[model samples]
Target chain A: MFDLSTPQRQSKKVIALYAFKSLRGFIFFFVFAAFGMRGFLEGLAFTGLVLFVAATSLIGPVIQYLFFKFHIEQDEFILNKGWLFKEKKAVPLERIQSVNLEQNLLQRILKVYSVQIETAGSKEKELEIKALDESAALSLKQALLDISNQREEQEKTEVTEPEKKTVNPTSNEVSSTLLKLSFLDLFKVGMTQNHLRSGGVAIGLVVGSYFKFQDVIKQFFGDYLDGWEWENLMSFASLGMLFSFLLIFLVFSIVVSLITVFSNYYGFKAVVYQSHLELSMGLIKRQEIRVPIEKIQSLEFRTNPLRQWLGYSTAYIYQAQSDANKASKVSIPACKKEHIKILQETAFKDSVVDATIDIPCNGFSYMRLASYIMLATLIPTLVPLAYFGDYNWVVPMLIPAVVIVFWSYMYGSNSGIVTDKGFIGFKKGWLFKSFSISPVFKAQAVEKWDSIFIRRREEMHVKFHTASGSNGLRYFKKDAVNHLLNYINNTVIKSNRNWM
Target chain B: MTNEQILTHSLPDIESFSFEKHPKRFLNKKLIANTLYMIPLAIAVGFLFYNFSEFPWLGWSGLGLWAFILLFSLFVNYKEYFVRGYTLREHDITYRKGWIFHHQITVPFNRIQHTEINHGPIDRLFNLCELEIYTAGGSSSDLSISGLDPKDAQNLKSFVAGKTSTHV
Candidate 1:
């Protein structure tokens, strides 16, 4: 649902940069261009691909720069824009939540910023103007803020209009509003990320990048890579095996960890306003998101297995009304490192401890099948070993199988619980970084899932449903789950409170 | 001034909120017809499975699941079929609903941001409408009466939304 308002503008360059960042397909493009061309068919494919990219790249920018136009009338911003179905949005100044400025490196280089005006707080982004005049963006933001302040004053205190202060936004840019983090701050971040999330963030990056680059890798062991070969295949196979063991496997992990370090990079600053908050982040490609104060539904603090080990917890703000589902609208995604503590100290200055119940380690060994997924290697390798009778395929499977068994044993051993006298937490994500935290009052529904198998073992999946989202504790110590559930279910029922 | 006399309108005879009334419809026939048009396609799917699905297990399973699902939906709706009463209190509006799982939701007039009167083809057939009261909380905490006569629904919405004037 779009607001029928004043001005409308054209295509955004930031979106183009984001679309191009899908590095997976870009790797394939190089492969397709380098050697896989089939002369005439190749020429046709290349020509079509070039034309398609050109048209798409041109359409977004053209619509943003030319067709979109917006202007402010007496009390609202009127936006008009359309490529096919002409749409006009009227966003009343009173309904405006936050007016944010977004400029990526490309936008910054081009000396332009896209403006997003959101009101109903349904995670829709509600993009208003792209490639806007920076001065216009500033003035419009100030105008909305000024109107909100006036309305709040009138609505809350029942006061008459006070003389409006002419805000010179250009001159006020230097007031400690900008927060920048440097290399020293990275150390604080490093200290907060325990071995788990760091390893998870690392291994996930490595594995993801390695699989992504599989298309580019032609011959790892020359001819010995697929079938049975001897002669110099042994020499090359040894070399390739060494290369994987040393460089591709080990060094790749380091590279992936480094990439994750940049991906989770946060020079995050929430520019707090009277009624709205503007969030700016990104080290390479900067982005600013604005969330209205009223749209925030519920807030939670969670510690991944890593952060918990490091004695740190992260604060996440769950907002209502995204373009689609409300459960997934996380505006203030986890504050980096000690910033969570700072957030709790400042942003949640008047809050009590959320969950008194200690985190529970749900002892579910079956879940480790994902972490130790190399067990499937035997099936693929066995098929080839039986049909082709080649022992070479079996070696690749053995290496992964060993790693999988080790992974399963380690994950299984680490599964344990530390429940408190009051709240309850369930840990489940992966071996790298599991999420576990729960607040008592927030749990809306408690469900016990028992299939025929689970009931035999006297174990069940306990689901704790908060209004927006629910996390299920799978195969927990049934005695503990049942006991806490009984007490919690009773407490919630006894108290006459508005739940639904 | 009574609470329902939100904004003064020409005084029309005020009717006490009742559980009994000839249901007036709020919805256009086009929407209901479009929704009802899907039944044939569902029958066609069952027919296609019965005739063409080479695998007997697949055909039987598909038809069985559809039958079960259709039956379950009917059961839920049958239990929920309700006619609720709505009235204007001194400072608030009260709506009582629920055939099986009953509820009486109350909304203060001052807290109401807007009011809506909606109807579908089924509602139109029975001369009924769904009257909704909106507030800040996105929760279904707002009062919704599903089976009100069209005129009563309009009057309730107009009255609650502060469009009703006593002068009418």
Candidate 2:
């Protein structure tokens, strides 16, 4: 059933997105070619032959404009249409946690933006509204603010209408704070992020696969090798392997550098609206990411070794938006260090806290880290050696195992948590650090855990869980972790404000 | 902090939970509780009843287990009704379970989302009900407060709700 689409707008600009439009058609054409069902495309071809219609008109853009329709609602944003069925949802403003706006090269050319409203759940309750001119999209943010203000009024009234102290609810708006990343800030971010490792891994896989495929050709198509001693070539295979490894590591690092330079430096701009923070960047596939002021679990200005040396810092926010298996990582494609603290202070404008949280790691972290990392190397060696008795993969694996052990040491050494006047920060990881955060009142569950192993060593793990995210300190001296946990727990409990 | 200062600074005074609201014979002695645990032996008895003609030995063992369980339950119930006592701290609600394990969980009032008081058919006959508390992070962390009086359970619900992050 299709309901009528109702939209509120600051202006009359809508984005018609063909997210996978060309790909969808291409796939359908190729897949249907097996059964000789290329009717529509062939028909178009035949008509082209008959009419000789060359560049008569470009109707693709005209046709796409007719396919999509969306508009903002009072408390939510709405989209209506269906090649099959139209679905409409009443997303209350209070339920929405964040709104992200993205723009690509095409959108930038059109001077438009795509807005996404993320609600509180796993169901992807995001209303991805695209094709709005930048100014129209900017003004649309006011609608979101208006609704959030209404939700606050409702909460206050739901508690005690008669006890209302404020006469005007709408007058007090959450002031917006904007953070911008500079070239050096972005450069430092590129260096500190896991972007390099992943790029290296991808290069390895591609080169490794290319070599393996060529080797397969030599085996099955020996004549193609042209009397090249194919049968006795197993010994010299290590040359190919070594060369591939070097190529991956080198090419990957270069690519990583290029990506970092391009992504962070292109067109980065972060703006603070009344209730939301929006960031837009990307030279090619431009993107805009937004965060609600309330859902921001932790925000910080971080300086890694390289960044510290360069005298620049990166700003990031660690929000809770993931399953327990995969916590939401910080996003700082690139930014100057000064912007991070500015974002933190300005994001919570009226909050009383003017402090920070500190994280400390003990020697046990190294032990814990090593044990987890060893699994990567140990399992492959033992399994293949036991089952297939193959030394090819096992010998190659030790290199990765050694590298992992070194990285684990770095990770364990760097992890720490800090608590200052009103703010608390828990920093963990070395290669890619994740600093989880919270206002003191958000601690949902506090526990001091000591295992049989830890008890003997006089060590402990203290954790404080929050609604969407958790901030924890592990492998600390038992008393210190306990005191911190107790203090935070008591601090959260004593506050009259409710945290959800 | 001084005692008086601590009192003023601590969390809200969430009271109203009392022992009079728990089920009769809620707690039990160690030996009697262990013996009463044999009630699940009735499942084995049911298996025996169906094949009693084929396995007469199993039928006899099942009956012996059932008799032991019934007598032990009566003894256990007597001790539990008289021996156990519980206390509620100002900000937290504590539940003490077992004669042997002797462990207690103190749940702070603000952290509790909602409490559900449910009674099984058999529990109804024994005037026993279980109060289940659900917290925010999914389903697994739910706390079950077993063996509480129905009336006190209602009062505890309101008292805890007053301190909850959400009103309803």
Best model per TM-score? 2
Query: Which 10 consecutive residues of model 1 chain A have the lowest summed lDDT?
Result: A169-178
lDDT of 1 by residue, B52-108 (tens): 768777667766776776665555444434333555655455454434433333444
Q: Model 1 over residues A362-470: C-alpha lDDT tens digits?
A: 3344444433455464676588687987877677767766766666555544443334433444444344544343445344444545544445565655655444455
RMSD of every candidate to native, in Å, equals: 12.2, 10.2
**For candidate 1 chain B, which ten residues in a row score worst on lDDT?**
B6-15
In model 2, how many backbone clashes occur?
Answer: 20
The candidates' interface RMSDs, in order, read 15.0, 6.6
- Cα lDDT tens digits, model 2, B45-139, are 87787877687877887788788767766665554444343444456554444332222333456767678889876556556677787665433
Candidate 2 local Cα displacement, residue A16, angstroms: 6.2
Error of 2 at A95 (Å): 3.2
Best by lDDT: 2
